[model samples]
Target: MLTIFLSALALAVQTTPVPPQTTQLPPAIPPVSTPAKPVVEADLRPYVALVTDLGTITVRIETRRAPITATNFLRYVDAKRMDGFQFYRSTKSWGPANQLVQAGNRGDARKNFPPIAHEPTTTTGLTNCKGALSMARLNPGDATSDFFLLLSDIKGFDADAPGGDGAGFAVFGEIVAGADVAEAIFNAPISPTAGEGVMVGQMLEPKVTIKTARRVPAPAEVPQGCVVKAG
Candidate 1:
């Protein structure tokens, strides 16, 4: 009986099934760094002053937000591209006591520099509000040295969506000082049946001359985020 029981126990042990084995996976590799988006300084906002016949209109170029656009504008300035350009057009009646003044080559094909990339509000988060400085572009990425000064807060001009007419204009800075000068240009007389489309009769009869546009350090007295010249 002991021999039979021992033989039965040995048989039961042999009949037990074995569990399936799993291979250990190697440690997962970390993801590669993205290449399209590069790191840029987040706290560098510079200023540039436009000396016009009316007065000096200083704009705070938003380097942190719109680096490409700001750099493009500075390229034109450093190259003395807009020295002789003028505020040639103003669009009034869009808003009461407010308008947009267009300044640049005044349709001079010879004065334009190479067009820069379009920095829409969608990318920069900058809006077409009062005192905003925006590049005047016919189509996206078609803006050269021409820019506009907003006299009123116009949300319609701000970039609401990406591509297909909603990309809007590339606003790089704002009129920190000499808003009075901008207002003067806004109120300047317009020609009857002279301009095309919405710009009809919105052209400044005598364009305000821009004597110079240069980079200047901001004074300690003025606001930090803005730029202005002291008397």
Candidate 2:
């Protein structure tokens, strides 16, 4: 009877459930540092050149940034439409210091093309800085063959400002060289006859012209530099 009781107790103890052992894993090792992503630099060298007959003017076109405006300018250039076009306006509003020169005559029945949508500075990431080149427009989606070059920094004309109608002018290019030529173009004589037909309220001189324009190959890499001003 004692042996039977002892055997029964042992069997009961063996059948009881035992608590599972908790596991403590080893600390995880951190990964090593990796290289950072490379910065995407825009190539602006192919845009460097002289507009010729206007002095040694170096131009910088922003095709990657301002595709529409740049493409418009290039279209005219490729078609030889701007070869003999005139710089019809030179506003005294800027004076010599505020040198603002304009060219193009898409409004003319003889030289007109279909209007294009407004590509403001905000769209192109270009500003109306001194020597900046911007598309000319009346209302949104009305840009044609006209463009303007800033003689002085015109902050008021920026996109989303009072002048831009919340959509500032499109800036596709800049004068990288021959600022003196730009100055000369700025200082060219003017007639008082309200300039070109398109430039109402603003005066026009019809003094300068786009003797020629061409599309050189784009650069493989962007050149680190700033516009070289005249002495």
Candidate 3:
């Protein structure tokens, strides 16, 4: 979202003799087409379980909408690369209440893979609501394996306006179970001077270790649409 690229192409034109006089007609205006809203078919989704020391959190990924983001996360799960990962950062200082526990590789360059494209909420039709799962990226198409869980609704993360951060983080999934566990990690102890800048006091003192992550069956009672209902 923060990056932009421009390319120019040069075309060669040959001069030709013209007749005495000729009439030219103005070009016809092209018709405008409206964009159709994307549907999140439940059948196209896949689920994963984050087995952490706190507890197990089941997540239902919206494969139909955030395919790249969801697939990027599943690659880590299938490769068993998420094992021993830790929720190293907790941004309770972000608001008056503690919300969300940040995890993934925790900034280890070796653990990172190629980043995926930025899928804005406007295009995906997925809101940054409570229990929503989103991809973390430095810029558009820079998201790799790192992600976060929303403990509450935060629509500001969605595309702010025409030129917003490509409509915020790409929400690929949502928590369907283990809300208590996510909350526990969100409220875990933090070091006052650990994280960088404003996130200093928000970093967890003892990072919560992710015991294991594996693919699981999608919940039978999942509500239709791209978002996961907060457990």
Each candidate structure's TM-score, on Cα atoms with residue i matched to residue i, is 0.73, 0.67, 0.74
Worst 10 residues of 1 by lDDT: 222-231
Off by over 4 Å in 2: 1-53, 96-98, 106-111, 162-164, 196-206, 217-231
Residue range 85-145, candidate 3, lDDT tens digits = 8898877888844366789886466877777778887777777788889887778788877
lDDT of 2 by residue, 145-201 (tens): 888878888766677567446876777788765678877776676665564564553
Error in Å for residue 19 of model 1: 75
Which candidate has the highest TM-score of all?
A: 3
Query: Rank order by TM-score, top first?
Result: 3, 1, 2
Model 3, C-alpha of 176: deviation from truth (Å):
0.3
Q: Which residue window of length 10 is worst by lDDT in model 2?
A: 222-231
Local distance difference test, each candidate? 0.79, 0.68, 0.79
lDDT of 1 by residue, 50-136 (tens): 898888888888777788888888887888878888887887756564478898876567777788888888778778778888889
Each candidate: RMSD: 12.9, 9.6, 24.2
Where model 3 places Cα greater than 4 Å from the true spot, the runs are 1-42, 161-166, 220-231
Of 1 and 2, the candidate ahead on TM-score is 1
Candidate 1 error regions (>4 Å) = 1-43, 161-164, 224-231
